[model samples]
Target chain A: MDLIRKTNTSYLIFLAFLMPIMIGADYFLIQYLFNSEVEETLLHEEERIQYHLAKDGDLPISNYLHEVTPIDKGFELNPKFKDTLFFEAYTDKNIPYRLYSFSSSIDQKPVKITLRHMLPEIEELIWFFFIATFAILLLLVIGLYLIHQEIYRSTWHPFFKNLSMLKQYDFSKMESTQLNSSGIREFEEINQVIITLMEQVRKDFQNLKEFNENISHEIQTPLAIIRNKVVHLLESKNLNKNELRQVESIYQETNKLSKIGKALTLISRIENQEFKRLDRVDVSTLVENILNNMEEIINFKNLDISTELQPMTIECDHILADILFTNLINNAIQHNKEGGWIKIRLSTDTFEITNCGDVSEVKPDKLFDRFQKGSSSKDSLGLGLAINQKICEIYEFTLNYESKEEIHTFSLRFKA
Target chain B: MKVLVIEDNLELLQDIKSFLEEEGNICEIAPTYKSAMGKIGFFPYDILVVDITLPDGNGLDIIREVKKENIDIGIIIISAKNSVGDKIHGLEIGADDYLTKPFYLAELNARIKALYRRKAYQGSREIYFNEIKIKPDSYEIFINDKPMNLTKKEFDIIHFFVVNKHRLLTKEAIAEHLWGDHIEMADSYKFIYTHLANLRKKIGELGGKNYIQSIYSVGYKFTDQEWT
Candidate 1:
C-alpha cells in the first residue's frame, strides 16, 4: 500500500511540473506572434508616410511623425509604461503618419504608417490575443487536473484499494478477497506479489496447526498409561496371589508411558524439521521387516495370509516408512475378526495390505484423523493412520484405504 | 482369570503385577513389542492389558494382530491419550474396554472383571463371590441361597463394593460416582458415610460380616477380611 501511494504521488508531481511549463511555453509563443504582427503594421505605416512626404511637400505631417517617434522612444525608455499607443495623421494624399509608442523614452524613431486608420482595430486584436493566452493557460491547468484524476481512478486507486484488502487477509478465515482489475503493469506485479505472500502465510499456518495437534496426541498416550497404572495400584485390594499380576500390569503401563514420550519427541522432531536423512530404501525389505515383526500376532490369531509380489525398490526415509507400515498393518490385523484373512501385496514401487476387519464405524474421509478408528476394536491410539498419512505426505507417496464387506485395505503407491 | 500385561515401564508394570497377583490372578509381562507378540501368540489369557505406546512398536498394532488371529482373548486398551477419538478408535477395533492413563489400577481390575463377565456370562447376569451372589441387572443380593432385603442405597453401595472388591476406592470418587454430575456442588460428603454405615449394619443384621474397610484420610476398601 505504501508503494502504491508513493508511485501515485510521484506521478502527480510529474504532471504538476509538466503542465505549467507546457502552458507557459504556448503562452509565450502566442504573445511573440502578436507582438511581431503589431510591429509589421507599424513599419508599413511608416513607409507610406515617407512616400507621402516625398510626393507632396508635407513637412508638417512628417515633423509630427518625427515628434511621435520620441514619445514612442519614451514609452520604451519608461519601464513602468507597459502598453503601446499609436496615433495616425492623414496627409492630403491620404497617406498617414503613425506614432507607435511602447511607453519607451526613445521618441526620435517613431514609425509612420500608411494604413493608419486600422491602428485601433489592430490594437484590439493584440489585447484579445493576450486575454485568449491567459484563458488557454487556465483551461490547460484544469484539463491536466481532470486527466490526472482519471489516471488515478483507472490505475492507482484500484491497485491501492486491492492492496488494502491484503491488510485484512487472515488464514483462520480462509477467505480471500478478489483483486481489483489491474490496468497497468506495475499494479499487476504488485498484486501477484501480495497474492503469493498470502498463500505462503496460509500454508504455514496450516502446517502449524497440524504440528500442534500431532504433538498433543503423541503426549497423551504416555500420560494415560501412567494414570491408569496408578489408579489400578491404589484401588485394588485383592491379596489372593494376584499381587504379581498387578505388578506386571503397572510395569507394562509404565513402559507404555515412556514409549509415548519417545513417540511425542519423535513427532516433534519431524514437525520441527530435525531429521532429513534419506537413502535408497528397499521397499521389499522394509515391508518384509514389518511383516516379520508382526509374525507373532499373525500366528496367534490364526489368520490366513495371502500375498502377491513383484520386486520393487524406492528411495525414501526408511525409518519413518517402516513405522508407517507397521502402524497400518498392525491396525488392520488387530481390528479383524477371528479367523480373518490378511492379504499383503508388493510391486516394484507400490505396496498394499488388506485384512478382514469391521470398518463400519469409521468414516472414510476421517480415517486418517488422529485417534479416529472404526468399531471392531478398542485400545488403539488411532495414530497409525495419522502417522501413515504424514509419512505419505512427506515422501510424496499416495496412501489410501478402502473398506468393503469387512475387508479393510490399505495401499501405499510410491511416486515414480 | 488370566491376564497378560504388555507394557514397557518397569515401575508401573511392577505395581500392576503386584496388585493383580494379590487378587489371585496370574499376569504375564511382555515389555516390548517383540515379547508382547510372542506372549499373545503362545499364551492363552482371559484378558490382555495392552498400552498403545510400546517400545518395539505401538500397542495398538499388537491389539490389531491378536484380533486378526481370532483369539477370543478379552482386550483392555490402556492408553495415556484422553482424546475422545482415541477412546472411540480403541473400542471400535474390538477392544472390550479402553482406559486412559492416570486411571486407578482398581478400575482396570474392575474393567477386566467386567470383560470376563461379559465374555463368559453373555448377559445371563450374575456376579458370584463365595456364598454371596448378586444379580446385577435386578440389583438383588442372595446370601446362602436366601434373598436379603436391602435398601436402594445400601444395595447400590454393596453392589459397587462387590464389583470393585479387593480395591481401595477413594471417597471423593465414590461420592462423585454415586451422585453423578451433581457431585461438583456437593457441600459435604457426610451422606456417603451415612449410606455406608447403613449398608454395613444391614449386612451385619443379616449375619454377614463387614467387607468394607476404611483407609485413613483416603477412602474405603472392600475385601473379604478373613480371606485376606
Candidate 2:
C-alpha cells in the first residue's frame, strides 16, 4: 500500500476503538457523582426537620418527603441514611428515594421521623448522556479524519509529481531532472540527490559513447595502414606460395578487425540514439532487394527461395530497416544447408522466414547476443542477429525465433 | 592521370603514392592539411585522394577548399569513419566517391582508375586489356569485336580485374568488391571460384586467352602473360 493510504487506514482503526472507550469512561464518572450529590440533599432535609422540631416545638405533617411512624416506649431504632421506596398519592407511583431516619421524641410522644429525597432517574440520564457522547465523538472522528486527509494530500503532492518525473526521465534527450522545491525538507533533499545522481548517470553514459567512437577510429586507422601494406606485400615478386598464403591470412584478419570495429561502433551508435532520421520505408521492397542481392550466395548452397509479399510499410530509420532485413535474410541463407528450401511470407502486419539448416545447439535466449553463433565458423562475425534485435527493439516490433530439429524460423510482427 | 594524395599518415601516403605511381599515374603526396592546401593552390591535378582525419584539419575541409578552385578535379574521400551521415555529407559536398579505410590497395587502385575515367572530358569510356574490351558504363565486354554475354557480377569481376591488372587480388578483396562492404560473404570463397571459372570459360570460348591465374590457392593474379 502507498504511504497515505496506509497511514489513513491505521488512524481510522485507532479512532474506532477510542470512540467507545472514551464514552464508557465518561458514563461511569457521571453516575457516581450523581449518586453522591443525592445522598447529601437527603441529609440536608433531615437537618431542617430537626431544626423545626427544636425551634418551633411543632412537627410537620407526614408526606412522601417525611414519613412518621409511632413507636413503643424505649424503642431501639437505627438512625442513619438508607435507600427506600415511597408511594405518592397524587402520582400513584413508587419512586426511589435517598432517606435519612431517626427515632426522636416529637411533641413529647415517642415517634420515628424519616426524611426522603427523590433520586434522579439514572437510566434516563444515562440514555441522554449516551446519545450526546455518541454525537460528539462522531463529529470529532469525522472532523479529524477529513483534516488528516487534507494534510496528507497536500504534503505528498510534490513527492508524487517528482516521482513520476524520475520514472519518465530520458537520457537521450539530455533533459535535466531538476526537481522543484516542495517546501518539505526531506522531499526536497531527496529530489536534489536524484537530480545529482541522474546528472552523473548522463555524464557517464555520454563518456562511454564517446569512448566507443574514439576507440573505433583509433583502431581503424592502423588497420587500414596494415591492410595497405599487406596488399603491397602480396604483390612482391620475392614471395613464394607459403609466404603469399600467410600474407593473405594476415590481410583477411585485418579486414575482419576493421569490420568488427565498425560493427561495434554501429551498436554503440544505436544505443546512443544517434540515428534520428525517420522515413517511411517499404518492407516488401527492402526484403526483395536483400534477397535479390543474396541470390548468388543462395545458389552456392543450392537453396530454394520462395517469397510472398504484400505491400507493407513502416516509419523508421530506413538504414536500420535495410540492415535488419539484410541481417535476417543473410542469416537464413548463411546457416542454410545444401538442397535446403527457404520460405518467406510477408504481410502488412507480420513477416516470417523459415529455412532448414544444421541443427543449432545455441541456446534460444543466447541467440541474439553479439558473437553468439549457432555454428563455429571463422568467417562469420556472428553479429547479425544482435543488430536485428536492436533494431526491432527500437521500433517496438516483436521478433520471435523458434527452431525445431533442423528447421529454424524467425517472425517479426510490427506494431500497429 | 595526375593525382594528388592528401593524408596525414606518412606511411599510408607513401603506400598509396607508390601503388598509383606504379600504375603509370603521376602521383604527388601531401602529409598535412597545410601542405595539401599549399600544393593544390599552385598545381592542378586530375584527382585528389583525401583522408577525412588529418593532423591539422579534417580532410573534408580540403575537399571543400579544392572544390572552391573549380579545377574539374575528381575527389575521393577516404575516412576511417564508416558512418552513413559522413558518407552522405561527403557526397553532398562534391566528393566523387567515398571509400572507408582498411581497404585493399587494389580496390583503391580500381576506384581511382574508375574515377579518372569518369572525370576525363574526352576519352574512351571503354578499358582495353590485350583485346579484352570492357565498357564499364553498360557492363558489357567485347573480344575480337564480338559482344560477350556476362552476368552483372561477372561483368563486375572482369571490370575489377581489368582495372587492377597484373596485381594480386585476394579472395577477400574480390568478395568485398563484388558484394559491397556490408554483406557477410566470408563463406563466399566458393561463390568466387564458381563465378571466376564461368567467367574464364566464357572468355576462353570467345577465343580470348585465360589471363587470370590462381596464386597458391589464396588469391588470383591477372597478367598479360598467357596461361600454359
Candidate 3:
C-alpha cells in the first residue's frame, strides 16, 4: 500500500513540476515578444517623425527623433529614443551604403540605424516562438492529465478494486483464489509473498488432515475390534446374567465412544475438503426424508413438528448437506424437553428449523463453536452446529441462529 | 426356524451362528456375497442375516435382488457404517432391519425374531415371556394366559419394556421409544410414572408377579428373576 502510494505521489509531483515550468517559460517569451513588437511600432514612428520634420520644417531630423516623448514602457525602445537604441540591420551587399545612427539627445550626435530594419522580423519570430511554446505547454499538461487517468485505470484501479475478493477468500479453497502473474515485478513480488503464505497454510492444513485421518482410522479399528469382541464374549455362554449386564455397560460406553469418534472424523474430513458437489438437492425433500425416519422417535418423545415447506432447490454437496441437516435436526430433537414443538419452514432459497428449548445457559453467538453445549444433554457432543457451520462455509451457504420466545431457529439460506 | 447368516468375519459369524443355535434355532453360514446369493436362492430360511460390507458387493443389493425376484425374505443388514443415511437406505431398500456392526448377537437375534414376527404373522401373534403374555394384534395382555385389563399407554410401555428387556434403557431412549422423538419436550418422567402405575395396578389385579423396579434417577427395570 505504501509503495503504491509512493508511486502515485511521485507521478503527480512530476506532472505538477512540469506544468508550471512550461507555462512560466511560455509567459516570459510572450512578454519578450510583445515588448519587441511595441519597440518596432515606435521605430516606424521615429522614422516618420524624422522624415516629416526634416522635409517640412527647419527643425533638425535628430531633434525631431529626440523630441517624440515615450508613450509608455510597452516597447523596449522609447519613441523619443528609437533612433538612438542599439540594433542591427542589413541590406543586400550588392548595394553598399553608409549607415549611421544619430543621437537625438546630444547635439550633433551620430546614431547608427544599420540593424534597425531586422528588429521587426525578429519581433515576428519571437511572437511565433511564444505562440508555439504556449500551445505546446497547454497540450502537454492535458496529455499529462490523461496519462495519469490511464495509469490509474490500468494499475491502481485493478489493484484496489479486486482487493475485496482477497478479503472474502474462503481459506478452505486456498488454491482456487491464487493470483495470476501480473508481469509487473513489484506486484509479482507481493503475489509471490501471498502465495508463499497461502502455501504454508495449505501445507499445515494437509498435515493436520493426514494426522486426523490417521488418528480416526487408528482409533476406529480398535474400537471396532473391542465392540465385536465384547459382543462375542457376551454370546460365549460362559457369562451369567450379572456378567452380561456388565458387558452391556461396556457396549454402551463403546457406542458413545464410537459416536464421538465418528463425529470427530467427519469434522476432520470437512476440514480436509473430502467432500464433493453432487446434483441440485431439493432441501424440502431432504428435510422430509430425515423427519420421516425420525418419526418414531419424535412420536415417542411426544414432540410436535410443524413444517411449512416450500419447493426449493439448491446445488449443494450432498454429503455435507446431509450431515448439516441431520445434525441440526438431531440436535433439536435431542436437546428439547419431551413433548416439545419443532417448527420448520422453507422458502424458495431459505430454510428455518426451529425447536422449543431452554437455552438460558448458552450465549447464542458461541452456539456454533465446538463442544459448547447449552445444556447437559448426554447425547449432544456440541459438535453438531460447529460441523454444520463448517459445511456451510465450504459450500458458501449461510447458516444463522436466532432465538425468540424460547424457540431456537437455525436458518439456512442458499445463494442463488 | 433356520437363519442364513452372511458375514465376512469368521469369528463373528461363528459367534452369531453358535449364539442362535444355542437359542434353539438352526444356523446356516455364507461368507461371501456369491455364496450368500447362492444360499438365499436355494434355501427357504426364516430369516436372512446379511452384512452390508461384503467381499463382493453391498448386502443391500442382495436385498433388492431378492425383492425383485418376488421372494418374501426377511433381511437384517448388519454394517459397520453407523451413518443415519446408511440405516435409512438399507431399510428403504426393503431390508426388514438395520443393525450397526459390532452389535451383540443377542441384539441381532432379537432383531431377527422381530423381523420374523413381523413377516410371518404381519405382527398378529400372542408373544409370551414367561407368565407375561402379549397379544399385539388385539392389544391385549395376559398373566399366565389370563386376560388383564390395561390402558393403552400401559400396554405400550409394557410392550416396549418387554421387547427391549435386559437392556440399559435411558429415560430419553425410553421416552423416545414410547412417545416418539417429540418426547424431548416432556418436562419430566412424571407420565412414565403414570403409565407404570397403571401397568402395575392391572398386572397386580391379575395376581401376577410384580417385576417393575424403579432405578432411581434412571429408569424402571422389569426382570424375570425378581418377578418369579
Candidate 4:
C-alpha cells in the first residue's frame, strides 16, 4: 500500500516473468554454437577416413565408426542428415548422436559414409550456462530492491516530519512551527507556503480579538457614565412623583443594559479562547461552594436542596469553572417552584443537577441559546446557560439539558 | 476627608466630585493620568480614586507612583474593563480596592469610606450612628451599649447605613452592596425591602430608636432627624 512496497512488488513480478525467458534464450544460443563445433569435427573425421582409404586402397578400421554398410545400388545424389541412437559396447547403453550420411565412390562402386557425434557434452554445457544466468539475474534484482528501499526512506523523511508538525500545531497558543529545510525543492516550497498561511491566520485572529475588547471597553464606559448621571439626577430634592418614576425606570434599564453588555463580552471572550490558564480544579468542591453561595436564593424560594458529591477533578480555567457552576446552580434556583426539591450528584466523570420546576415554556433545543428566556421571568438576561455551554465547548466537555415530568436536569461530562 | 477622583469621563467625574462634596468631604478632580500625577505629587489627600484606563496614561502606573510617594494614601481602582486580570494586577500594585464600571455612586461612596477608615484607624475601629454602634471586625453590633442579634445580611445593611448615614440609598445600590454581581439576576428588588424591614424590627425590639426612614417610592434614608 505504501510507495516503496508497491514499486518493489511490480518490479518483482516483471523479473519473475523475464528471468525464465532470458535463461531459455541463452540455452538455445549455446546449443547452436556447440552443434556447429561438432559439425566441424565430423567433417575432419570424414576427410581422414577418405585419405586412409585412398592410401591403403581399402577402408580403415577406427573407434569413431561402429559400422560400414555396403549398398547393392549406387548412393543418392544428396546427403541425408539425421539424429540416431547407437549402442556403446563399454557402457552397454544407447547414446544420442548427430548423424550425417553422404554418398561417395569406393572402388568405382557407390557407397554411403555416415559420421556421428554424441550430444551429451553439449547438453552439459547448456545446463551450466542456464543456471549461471539465472543466479546472476536473481542477485541483480535483490541488489536493486535494497537500493530502492534506502532511497525511498531518506527522500520521504522530511515530508513525514512536516506532516507531524502540522498535526501538533495549535492556533490558540499562537506559536509558529519551526520547519526544517528539506533539500528537496518541492518539499521546501510546501513548507514555505504553510508557514505563510499560518502567520496570516494568526494575524487575523489577533485583530479580531482586539476588536472585541475595544468594542466592549468603549461601550461600557458610556454606559457607566449614563448610569452614574441618572443616579446623580435622582438625588435632586425637587423632583415630583412622576419624575421620580421616570428616573427609576431609566436607572433600571441602564442596569439591565450593563448586565447584557458584560454577558455578551464574556460569551465572545470564551468563544475567542482567551481563558488559557488551565488547572486541575476540584469540581465537587466547586459545586458545593456554589450551592452554599446560592443558599439565600434557595431559601427564599423555600426549596429543599440536597447534594451527593464524589470528589472529582478536571482540568479547566478556574474562573470559568466558577462561572460554569454558578450559572447552572442559578438557573436551577431561578426556575424551581416554591417548596420544590433540588438534587445534585457528582461523580468522577460526570456531574448532574436536577430541580423541580414548572414545565418550561422555552423550547428544549433553544434552551442554551442567548436571549432565550423562559415565560415566567422576563427580567432574566438569559445569557447564563449560553455562557455555560460556551465554557463547556471550550473545555471539550459535554453539556446537556433535559426537561421531563416537571423536572429540569443539567448534566456535564468531562472528557477522560 | 480630602479625596482625589482621577477619571477620563468628564461628566462622571463631575457627578462623583459634587456627590462626595455634598457628603461634607473636600473633593478634587483630575480628568487625565498626567494631571492626576501632577495633583498627587503636589497635594496630599486622604484617598485616591483612580480609573485604571485613562486618556493620557495607565492608572496602574499612577497607583505605583503614588504608593512610592505616600504609602498612607488609600487607592481604589475603577475600570470599565471588569476582567479579573486587571483587578488582581491593580491590587498587586498597591490598590486597596477594585470596582467595575457601571457601579452605583452609593457603592463607590461606601468603598471610599471603608478604604479611608482602614487607612486612618489601622484596626479596632468602630462606627457610631447616634446610639447604634458597629464593630466591623468582630461582626458585632450594639444598640445603646447592648448586643443586638442580627444575621450577616442584616449586619451588613446596618453597617452600610451607618457609614453613609443621612445619605439616600437606592434599593439597587443596597442590593449590589449586599449581593455583589448576583443582584443582576433577581426578578425584583423586593428581597432588599424584606431584609431592611427585619433589621428595623430587630432594632426596635431592642429598645433602639428608629433611624431608617423610607423616601417614599425612591428608597430609604437613615438619619437621626425625622423628615416628612
Candidate 5:
C-alpha cells in the first residue's frame, strides 16, 4: 500500500517476465556459436582426410573422423553434406553429439565420412552463464529496492513532522506554529500555505471574539437603562392601576431579556475559549454547595432531596464548572413537581441528577437546544440546558438527558 | 455621603442620581471620563460609581487617577461586561466592588451602602430603621434594644430593606439580591413572599412597627411611616 512496497512489487513483476527471456536468448546464442565451431572443426577434418588421400594415395587415420567408407559402386552422385545431432551411448552418461555427414572421394573412389563432437562442456558452460546472469539480476533489484527505501524515509521525514505539528495545533492558544524547512521545494510550499491559512484563521477568530464582546456590552447597557427606568417608575406612589400593571410587565420582560443576553454572551465566551484557567475542581464539593444553596427552593416546594456523592476531582475551569453544575441542578429543581423527590449520584467519572416531574413534552433530541422550553414552564428562558451542554463541550465531557416515567435525568460523564 | 457617578447613558445616569439623592446622599453625575476626572481632581467625594467603558476614556483610568490622588474615595465599577477578567482587573486596581450592568437599582444602592460602610467605618456599622437595628457583619438584628432570631436570608433581606429605606424593592431585584446567579433559572419569584412574610411577622412580634409595606401588584417599600 505504501509507495516503496508498490514500486518494489512492480519491479519484481518486471524482473519475473524479463529473466526467462534473457536466459532463453543466452541459451540459443551459446548453442548456435558452439554448433558453428563444431561444424568448422568437422569441415577441417574432412579437408585433411581428403588432402592425405590425395598426397599419400591413402587416407590418414584420425580419431575425430569415424565411419569413413569407400563407395565402390552405386554411391550417391550428390556430394551434399548436412550437420545433425545424435545421442552417443558409449559413455556412462548418454551425451549429445553434433555430427556432419558428407560424401567425398578417397583414392579416386567415393567415400562417406561423418564427424561428431560431444556438446556436454558447452552445455555446462551455458548453465553456468544462465545462473550467473540470474544472480546478478537479483542482486541489482534488491540493491535498488533498498536504496529506494532509504531515500523514501529520509525524503518524507520533514513531511511527517509537519503533519504531526498540524495535528497538535490548538486554535485557542493562538500560538504561531513554526515548521522546519525540509529544503524540499514541495514540502516547504505546503508549510508556507498552512502557516498563512492558520494565521488568517487566528485573525478571524480574534475579530469575532471582540465583536461578540462589544455587542454584548452594547446591548447590556441599554437593557440596564430600560430596567432602571422601569424600577424608578414602579417606585412612584402616584401611578394608576393600569399604569402600574404596564410597568410591572415591562420590568418582568426586561428581566427575561437580560437573562437571555447574559446567557448568549456566556455561550459565545465559552465557544471562544475565554475561560482558560484550569484547576483541580472537586465535583462532590461543587454539587454539595449547589444543593445547599438550592435548599430554600426545595423547601419552598417541599420536595424530597437525596445525594449520593463520592469524592471526585477533574481538572477544569472553576467558574465554568460551577456554572455547569448550577445549570444541571437548577433544571432538576425547577422542573420537579411539588412534593416530588430528587436524587443525585456522583462517582469517580460521572455525575447524574434525576428528579420526579411530569413527563416532558419536549423531544429528547431537542432538549439541549437553546430556547427549547418545556410546554408547562412559561418563565424559563430555555437557555439553561444549552449553556450546560456548551460547557460540557468545552471540557470534552458528555452531557445526556432522558425523561421517562414522570422522571427527568441529566448525566455528565467526564473524560479522564 | 457624597458620591460621583460617571456613566455615559444619560437616562441611567439620571436614574442613578435621582435614586441615590432620594436615599439622602449628595449625588453628582459626569457623562464622560473627562468630566469625571475633572470633577475628581477638584472635589473630594465619599464614593465614585464609575462605568468602565466611557466615551472619552476608560473608567479604569479614572480609578487610577482617583487612587493616585489618595483621596480615599470608594470605587464601585458598574460595567455591562460580566467578564471575569475585567472584574478581577478592576478589583486588583483597588475598585471596592464590581456590579455587572442590567442590575437593579436597589441592588446597586445596597452595594454602594455596603462599600461606603466598609470604607468609612472600619467595623461596627449598624443600620437603623426607626427602632429596628441591624448588625450586618454579625447578622444580628435588634428591635427596641431586644435581640430577634433571624435566618441568614432573613437578615440579608432586612438588611437590604434598611439600607434602601423608602425605595420600592421589586420582587425580581430582591430575588437577584438573595440568589445572585441562581435567580435566573428560578421558576418564579414567589419564594420571596415567604421570606418577606417571615421577616414582617418576626418584626411585628418583636413589638416593632410594621415598616414593610407591599404596594399591591408592584413590590414592597420599606419606611418608618405607617401606611394603610
Candidate 6:
C-alpha cells in the first residue's frame, strides 16, 4: 500500500475497464462509415441502371454487382438497403453482401432492380482497426504511466527521507529535530511543523528533567536531617527499648527513602545523559573488582561462586560501567538462597550471571521496570534492574533475564 | 583538632558540630557561604567540612579560597549530588574527600578522622581503642600489642566502629559505609552481622574486652561498657 503502487493500480484498472468500451465504439464508428460509403455507390449504380433503361426502353446487361430486371408490380418502389449472404458456386461458402433493392418503371412498365456489394473484408477491417487503436491508446496510457511513476518517485523522495529522519529522532540524544526542507511546498510545511513541535517538546522536556533532578537533590537534605535527628534520638540513653526501636525504624526508613531518591536521581541522570566521560573500560576488571568487594557478602550467603572471564574492553562511561556491573552482581548475590551457587561467564561478545534464587513468576522484560522485582523481597528497592536496563540501552547492549526453576540468569550481549 | 563546618542548614550544622565536639574535636560553625568565607583563613582549622550547595554561594569556591590561602587544611565536600563527575571535580580541586548527603554522621566522622590523621600524622597514622591499635594506612590491626589475624571486611567494621566510638551505628550505616553503592537498596544487615560477629570473636580471643555493644535489633554501639 505504498503511494506509487496504489496510484498505479488504479491507473491500470481504469485502462483495463476502458479497453472494451473503446473497442465497441471503434466497431460501430467504422461500420457506420463503411455502410454510408457503400450506400452511396449502390445509389449511384441504381441511377445508372434507370438511365440506361429509360434511354433505350430495354433491360440493361446483368452483372453480379448490378442487375436490371423486370418484375410485375402494382405500386412504385422506394430504394432500401439490406444485408444478405449469397452462395458462390466456386467458393462453396456464403459470402456476405450489402444489397440495395428498388422498383422502377422501364418502358412505362414496373421493373425491380437489385444492386449488391460483397463485404468480405469487414471482419478484417474491424480487427485491423481494433489492433491499431488499441496499440496506440495503450502506448499513450503506458507512456503517461511511466512518466508519472518517475515524477512521483522523485517528488516524494524527500517525504520518505523525512520519515526516516523522524524514526531516528530521540529527545534525550539531541536538542533539536531540525529537518531539511524539500523543494516542494507541502513537504516543506511538514518539516517546518515537525521542527517547531520538536523545539517546544525539547523545552518542556528540559524543564521537567531539571525539575525532577532538583527535587531529587533538594529532598536529600531533609532526609539527611531526619536521619541525623533519628540518630541523635537513638543515642539518647534515657530512651526505653520501644523508643529505641521506633527511632531505629525511623533511621532505617530514612535511609531507604534516601536510597530511593538517589536511585531515581541516577536514573534521571542516565536519561539526561549527564555522564559523558567515555573511556575504554575493562569489563573483566570491573567485574573482578566488584566480586572482590562483595566477597564477604557472597561468603556469608554460603554461595558457591565461579567465574569464566575473557578479557573484555568496551567503550563506556567509567562510573556507569561500574554501577551496571555492581548492580547486576548485587542482584545475583541478594536474591540467592542460602548455600546457593552463582555461575558467571564473560566474553567479548556476551556476559552472563546465573544464580540459584527463588523461582521467579515475573517475566524477564517486566523485571527491568522500576519497582518491579522478581520476587517479593520487601526490602529490595526494585530499581536496580531498571537502572541496569537504562545503562544497557545507552550503550546499545542487549540485557536479558531468564529463570528456569530456581536458577535466575541475567545475560548481556555487547553489540558487535 | 579544630574543625570548621560550613553548612547553610542550621539544624544539620548544629547536629554535626555537637557530635564532633563530643568526639573531643573543637568544632566551629558557619551558617552561610558568606560566613564561611569570612572565617576561611582567619584560623588554620585542621579540617573544613563544607556543604557544596549553600544559600549564598558554592562551597567549591571556598575550597578554592582555602587552596589560594596556601594553608595546610583538609577539605571534605558534602553534597546531595552523587555524580562521579562532581565527586571527581571536588577531589581534583584539592578536596581530600567527597561525601554524599543523607549520609550517616558516623561515616562522616570516620572520614573526618581519617583525613585529620593523614593530615596531622604525615606517615604514621594509627588509632588506638583501649588495647586495640589500628594502622589504617596499611590495613593492619593489633590487639594487646600483638597483630590480630583479621580479614579486610572485619578490619573495616572494627575500624568504622572505633572511629565513631560511643555513637550508635546502625547496621544500614555500616553496610553503606563498607560496601557503599554496591549494597544499594538490599537489606545488608546479614553482611554486617556476619562480619561483626567475626570481628568481635577475633578481638575477644586476643584478650581485648568486648567494647562493641549490640543494641538490641536496632544497631551497635562501641564504648568501654560491660554487657548489661
Candidate 3 off by > 4 Å: A1-18, A25-253, A265-362, A390-397, A403-416, B4-23, B27-45, B54-73, B82-96, B102-107, B118-126, B130-160, B164-222
TM-score of chain B of each: 0.84, 0.95, 0.69, 0.94, 0.95, 0.94
CA deviation > 4 Å runs, candidate 2: A16-149, A237-249, A358-362, A392-409, A413-415, B121-124, B143-149, B201-210, B224-228
Model 2 RMSD vs true structure: 4.5
Question: Which 10 successive residues of model 2 chain A have the least lDDT summed?
Answer: A57-66
Q: Report the C-alpha lDDT of model 3 over A86-143, residue by residue, as the tens digit.
A: 3234543232212223323222332323223222344555567656765776676667
The regions of model 1 sitting more than 4 angstroms off are: A1-40, A47-416, B82-89, B128-134, B138-160, B171-214, B223-228
TM-scores (chain A) of the candidates: 0.46, 0.77, 0.61, 0.61, 0.70, 0.87
TM-score of each: 0.48, 0.83, 0.61, 0.69, 0.76, 0.92
The Cα error of candidate 3 at residue A110, in Å, is: 9.4
lDDT by candidate, in order shown: 0.64, 0.83, 0.67, 0.81, 0.83, 0.85
How accurate locally is residue B225 in candidate 5, as Cα lDDT from 0 to 100? 66
Question: Candidate 3, B212: how far from true, in Å?
Answer: 4.4
List each candidate's DockQ score: 0.10, 0.54, 0.13, 0.38, 0.50, 0.63
lDDT by residue for model 6 (B64-173), tens: 88898788999999988887787888899899999988888899999999998888998487898889999997889999988988778788888999999888898888
Candidate 6 chain A worst ten-residue window by lDDT:
A59-68
**Candidate 6 structure quality by residue, lDDT tens digits, A1-416:** 98878888888888788877888888888888888988888888778877877898766765534665777767657789999888888999888889999888777878777889887466787788789888987897889788888888788877888889889988876557667667998888878888888888888888888888888888998998898888777766778877777877787788788888898899898998888888999999999999998888888888899999999898989888988999999889888888999999998899999999888767776899888875656778888889999999998999998889898889999989
What is the Cα-based lDDT of residue B121 in candidate 4?
91
How close to the true structure is residue A8 of candidate 4, measured as C-alpha lDDT?
93
If ranked by DockQ, best first, what sequence of candidates would result? Answer: 6, 2, 5, 4, 3, 1
**True C-alpha contacts between chains kept, each model in order:** 0.22, 0.54, 0.03, 0.40, 0.56, 0.62
Question: Candidates 2 and 6: which is better by lDDT?
Answer: 6
For every model in order, what is the iRMS? 16.6, 2.1, 7.1, 2.4, 2.1, 1.9
Compose the digit string of candidate 2's lDDT tens values, residues A1-416: 97767877787788788867866787788767876786667666667767888888677453435778989888798878777777878889877787878877778777788777677666777778778987987787778778877877798788888888878877765666677678999987888788888899999977887888889767977888898888777766778777877988898788888888877877877776767888999999999888777777887789999999999799899989888888888888888887898899998999999999888878988899988886645688878788788788778998999999999999999998
